[model samples]
Target: MMGGELKRMDLTMCTTTHDPAPLSVEECERARLARDPAYDGRFFTCVQTTGIYCRPICPARPPKPENVTYCTTAAAAELSGYRPCLRCRPETAPFSPAWNGSQTTVARALRLIEDGALDGPGASVDGLADRLGVGARQLSRLFRKHAGATPLQVARTVRVQRAKRLLDDTDLSMTEIADQAGFGSLRRFNTVFAEVYHRPPSDYRNRKRKGRGSPTGHRALNPEPLRV
Candidate 1:
């Protein structure tokens, strides 16, 4: 073990070696220099010179290793007050954790939601936080720092994405889609889906399977919440 036990990364405060232990510094640096897509989302390259962070595959000119610091997540970098790269959009990086350590709060919350923690009419942020052993307010703060959305907003995005998939690949009706997507009512679903994607839910029904994305070519879930 290179350092001590892992703990919550208080990225909202500071970035230093004394903060929670990070991934292998040597490995993160090598991957950044290589411009390796394989390392994308595993870690981020935070440049002190530019006060910006980027994906490993970011096409912009690479910063000197001395001017760079590695962060395990976009939220960490952002919470530490670094902006996300305009070209790479670290928020949208594909996630694939290379370490076998504890999952970050974001990762765990996402896992729980994917496993149906946020499903059904009874699901709520307080319930999810209880499962994660954190308070609702704290969990929401973590999400907003890292995810650029509140826990409910994250769940709403998940529902909309699920509904979009159902619309594209399945023959489900509007009511069915709303119910399956975990909205309290079909009317609520329509209103939220339109607000987020700027299109009514029915507008996407039976849509072609090709090039599935928003007008900006980003996924409906992330919605270009670029924290730049």
Candidate 2:
């Protein structure tokens, strides 16, 4: 196939295919109740009492049917003002298929964002675009289409997930944790952590025992700049 034709074929393959109708709330509720990992990135479940949203694979008990709202994307849940659940690390769920198999600029941007491409030292959307050999604006448009989030928003999601992992698994100081988590500053880290997780990092860590499981078996925390 010609390059242009090949590109078109690739794009078509990556596009989401589904019935025009929405998945019934009942079906999503059943998926949530089952804690189905396969549905993790494909949908989000919101709890009425906590006002927090989680991926379908969240280990928390399923909420009553009357108390749940299903979302098609994490960005949709965030736009609706729902905070993410720390326990499930929804942001770490597998990337949308739109991102995984598509050959468009947006798909590449989504992959880079998952790798924390827009943050840490020497990282920017322009840098990402350069690496992908596309203009930054084109990259942004692709991200918005497939991810329902700007490039920056996608990057923030990745950072939040990294922060959550550090918060849950380590006793590292906040500043150290922030640095390791790819935040530019302790203040910025705190702000985003609270915004996404609905609590300060320290507060979340302090809620449970300092050490829940084995430490030595895990790698020691490293502050080196992360590529993803």
Candidate 1 residues 1-228, lDDT tens each? 112211223323334443353456666667777887767767777787778889988899888866777677677778777888989888774544423112387779987886668878678888998988888888887787777877676777788888888887787889998988888799999998888767777764523332365576655443333121
What C-alpha RMSD separates each model from the true structure?
A: 18.9, 21.9
Write the residue-wise lDDT of candidate 2 on 115-145 in tens digits: 6778787898889888888788877776666
TM-score of each: 0.45, 0.46
lDDT score of model 1?
0.71
For residue 57, what is the lDDT in candidate 1? 86
lDDT top scorer: 1
Alpha-carbon lDDT, every model: 0.71, 0.69
TM-score of 2: 0.46
